[model samples]
Target: MTTTTHALAAPPDLGALYRRAVLSGLSGFLRRGGDLPNTTLELPAVTTDVEHLGAYARVCGFRLRDELPATYPHVLAFPLSVQLMADPSFPFPLPGLVHVRNQITQFRPLMVDEVFALRVRMADLRPHERGQQFDVVAEAVVAHQVVWRDVSTYLRRTGGRGGPRGDVRREAPEPSGLWRVPADVGLRYAAVSGDRNPIHLNRFAARAFGFPRAIAHGMWTKARCLTAFEGRLPDALLVDVHFRAPVPLPSRVAFSAHADASGWLFALHDPRRGKPHLTGSINLI
Candidate 1:
């Protein structure tokens, strides 16, 4: 086993990356099971673009400010994380792997003018109720300090390997606010975020795989929830979200939030199905 590395002069081409991922998926499935090695890949440090950040902030309904959005680093690190997960050595097929949850922690507000190095690794392959799961860890380092971290958990529905059972948190409440999502929301977000995953782009593209319709990006959903927290959020905080169901394009959904002893508990759900699209908590660290 060897550590693979790439120094990107510019951001990755998501289309090409996905094609490669598809091929890797075919290879991994043929090999059955494998181990997730603890090798780290360091991507080139990138200087944030003010214009890009402003566009992302607007699309995600966040306030445009001097500081980068708390969820911005997760977007920056996504390409490398995808590469890590889709690498030929990865244990599971990329096509069926579900992004079940994401946890992000920001040590402090990061400025748009700063340059940060992104490091990505994978670990903790475990079992879930319906399948197997693992985590992709991404970190942002500015100067010599770690400024941000994101743990993205993905599930592959392959029965169970008897790994330890993960945490079991209480269910969030029914949503209090309703939102009508437009079909173009996914394309609009992809334009700014550089995530062109076909599953989120169009109905035809989505059905090419397995989804009945295009689904919203999990990160977009998380960002929108954070946007709602705006003024109430601390500069340093931790946000953990579990994605329960896909929010199909041109659909309506609901949102709810309440205060708990640890922090704020929030959820987005589909009223018709009585199922959560996402549930999360905000912990002030």
Candidate 2:
């Protein structure tokens, strides 16, 4: 066959490859947990073994017992995630995606002794827009629950992918619940997020930042929002949250969320302290 014929025989449109990534039938093409093809991701479990933690930290480039840091799960699941994108069936380009916001809840505090299985799958996808930027959102589930979640938007600079562009035009809600943070919680979150920002781990440093105590990880506050409504609302909640303040860690607080049929409102509160820590909202289905 001539070169022209061979070239013709090959396909031109690459978007078709994404459709081949078995659509598991969710809200949108990909929206809710279990909406993508069956994929299992097993993250190495953390253990009390001293050698293991040290070695794992060295290999992962994190300090030992320094708090898992909120971003740990993303690193934990990254190796397998490569396969999903390289498979050519998924729509996202590996390096082009940008994380708009990432949040994770420290359920029982990700300790050094617990072994966790990070079950990753695609959830919630639609053309995202920020003035001129466009991208998508996918949620990651750990075990059977959605623990670490991130809304990543990808910019197809070369051309358009023509993903769903159905974005609701509405007013953004403010977070009403705010609480004063305690000291101990800061220590624990630092352990999970692997971030030892002295402001979050040391009182003296916190004083420098003008905080009475070390503050919480921004992701931790985001995680608290996620944990507050985990499995309580629709299986999939597509929210666009912007973090503005660092919640003081370990603040004993009560939270109130008054979500109407049209929108969701979240607030952080420390009834005793009588102030707001951080505020954010999610557009629930």
Candidate 3:
């Protein structure tokens, strides 16, 4: 496969990229191909803004610190992923793509002042039991070394069969904590994360997408789960999570975490229904 690369001087405006994504969704219906684009987008140098970082930390429940959180790089690279998925050559519409899974491997904790390069590409297009899935892989580099990487798997619901089922059945664990997720949590996170997906913003918008009410962003749940292990996690480690069900806005949810020899297993579930919302694990590297 021949890969084409495009490098930008700075990060693209996420607002503009989001507009393109919505327009692409409308044009996607006329698209007839089923092949993923073999392309990559890169930002040569990127650094964190202290205010932005603080706002993000507050929203995700992380303490403000010099060292960046494990999930922070994803925020930096997200616009590039949006650009890739919104391109005309891409196979899927960006608006409805569901982020079903995410894996982040941090080689070492990155500092707030460090400058890093970012590269994002699409890969691993395959079938799923309910739809087709692909990976948006992003990497953060400093001094020619990859310091952090993330693979976010998005599912495009196209109605397929005989593919692997992504769901895992597990009994709900005892609650370690209870959280009262506010109705505007999605909007708050979106303000910082640039993920203003309609399904997460307002009830009216969510209804257009077939959701009863606005839902929380999946990444927010993952970040919130990590907050429980803040200052306790290894510097170099892997965090993997599967989004099981959406957490509706203004809901009560339970969080559980168990530790063993290798690492920690964690999950967020609906306490009343005994249904899992997000299940994840962390492994020391």
Output the number of the TM-score-best candidate: 3
lDDT of 3: 0.88
Tens-digit per-residue lDDT, 122-198, candidate 2 = 44444434222332222333456554454433332334543213233433244345444555766765554343446
Question: Worst ten-residue run, lDDT, model 3?
Answer: 161-170
> RMSD to the native, candidate 1?
3.1
Per-residue CA lDDT of candidate 3, range 1-285, in tens?
888889998887888888888888888888765788888899988988999999999999999988999998898898888888888888877877889899999999899999888999989888777778899999999999999999999888877633223557555469999999999899999999988888999999889977899999999999999999987898899999999889999999999989968799899999898878898989999
Give model 1's TM-score versus the native structure: 0.89
Ranking by lDDT: 3, 1, 2
Query: Per-residue lDDT for 43 in model 1?
Result: 67
Model 3 pairs whose backbones collide? none
TM-score of 3: 0.95
Q: Which ranges of candidate 2 are over 4 A from the true structure? A: 1-182, 270-275
Which candidate achieves the best lDDT against the true structure? 3
